[model samples]
Target: MIETRILTADDWRTWRELRLAALTEAPDAFGARLADWQGDGDREERWRARLAIPGSHNITAVLDGRPAGMVSGVPGPRGDTAELISLWVGPEARGRGVGDHLIQEVERWALRCGVGVLRLAVAPGNTHAGALYRRHGFAATDEPGDEMASGEREIIMVKYLTAEDRTARDVTAGDLSGGCAPPADSAGCAPRADPVPGG
Candidate 1:
């Protein structure tokens, strides 16, 4: 069973755990490095501040009682947009619907915040991640996105929330009451994807 929990600064420890695992397992997927959050840099206050980003929603997916994935949504500089960030799924939970659930949660939140567009950035050469975003209605744009530490530009994808999309979401709002449910088999779920470090 997979479940998602809305996280606050108080749940920084859980966020920290999943974050470290993400950076360690997929160093190429994010702009930030594991060392950036390790050693003396791994302080309690730092993790707390990360989760406390103003106007941001942080979520962690729990699979059978263990932390499985993490993602965040922060209102963009423009009032009408929100950017998805920090998306990662543990190997044990990959292809189990955790990634889809995390993304959907952010989409629902963006709708509530009245944002017309939801955006995200992907590392270049990450074809699987791009496909996953495309499946969720995000399209790559020619616009430049955040620059990574490696001097590469991230791929920007946007999903414009139309009136029809809003109405469909409204009709299914009740489905948000429970945790995300994975298919009976791994093959039934789409492969999970990674996002740029901060978006």
Candidate 2:
């Protein structure tokens, strides 16, 4: 079974461990390099600050009994939107529905925040990640995203949130089976102080 746990600054240690693993395993998938988070940069305060990104929501997925995936939703560049960031699924959980669960959790959080759009930037050439986002209703936009350290522009994708979308999500939110498990993709945020009640 796949279960998700909403994390907070207090869970920095857990977040730190999974984040380092993601950066190391999928070095090309994230904007932040693993080396950036190591050495002196690997301070406890830094990890705490990341998890405490003002109005951000952090989630880690547990497949059966092990941590298998992580994702974050933070207030976007625009107030009406939220950004999904730092998405990663462990190798052991790739064929499972962990990625879907993580994305759905963030979508629920965005709906509760009343955000009109959810945005994300997938690294160029990460086709699996791009297709995964597409399946979840995100589409590429002409708008440019942040330039990576390598000076390449990431592919920006956005999913517009509407009343109808919310209604449909509400109906299926409780169905944890998430249908067939899509191949987990490492792609890669929103919300209020208490965005998601009851975690």
Candidate 3:
């Protein structure tokens, strides 16, 4: 059976291991390089700091007692939006609905937090990953975001979810408008890893 759970500050060891694995296996998927974080005495500190974010939640998936995937979400500056950051699924677990499962958990977490919108960034050339997002209710936005350090152009996608008038399919992956980072006075989605992370 596959299992998934939200991460807390105490999950630092697992977080550090999985994050490093993600960076090592899919270097281009993240803005931060594995080398940048590896071997640092403060890596543990970084993991704790990230977990300490009050508005953030991290989900980790396990299959047969091994880590399979992870996804993180943090509240948008607007308080009504949530951004999915740093998603990654291990190679052996790709086709088992792990990605969908991870996203669903984020949705549940977002709804409870009163998030009205959900957003993520996709690297320009990954068609398969883009299709997956579209299937789940994410649509492309022409949002202007800084080019990732990997030289990949990013396309922002959004889903809108509200407590009322939400549909089964719609609620699965829902709402967004024109992208281009929220306005000067607005809070935009935070830096996310790759579009699919490593999907």
Instruction: Give the per-residue lDDT of model 2 (tens digit) for 1-199.
Output: 8887778888899998899999889988888888889998899888888886666768899987888999988766555788888999998899688888899888877766567899899888788889889999999999886677778888899999888966654533553322111112111122243432101
RMSD of each: 8.7, 7.9, 7.6
- Ranked candidates, highest lDDT first: 1, 2, 3
Which candidate do you rate higher for lDDT, 2 or 3? 2
- What does candidate 2 score in Cα RMSD to the true structure? 7.9
> Candidate 1: misplaced stretches above 4 Å?
169-199
Question: What order do you get sorting by TM-score, best first?
Answer: 1, 2, 3
lDDT tens readout by residue for model 3, 1-199 = 6787667888878877888888888877666677776676346677777765655667798988888998888766566777877788888988898888888777766665556798887777766667778887998887875477767777889988855623332432323111212223222334333232222
Model 1 shows how many backbone clashes?
0
Which 10 residues in a row give candidate 2 its minimum summed lDDT? Answer: 179-188
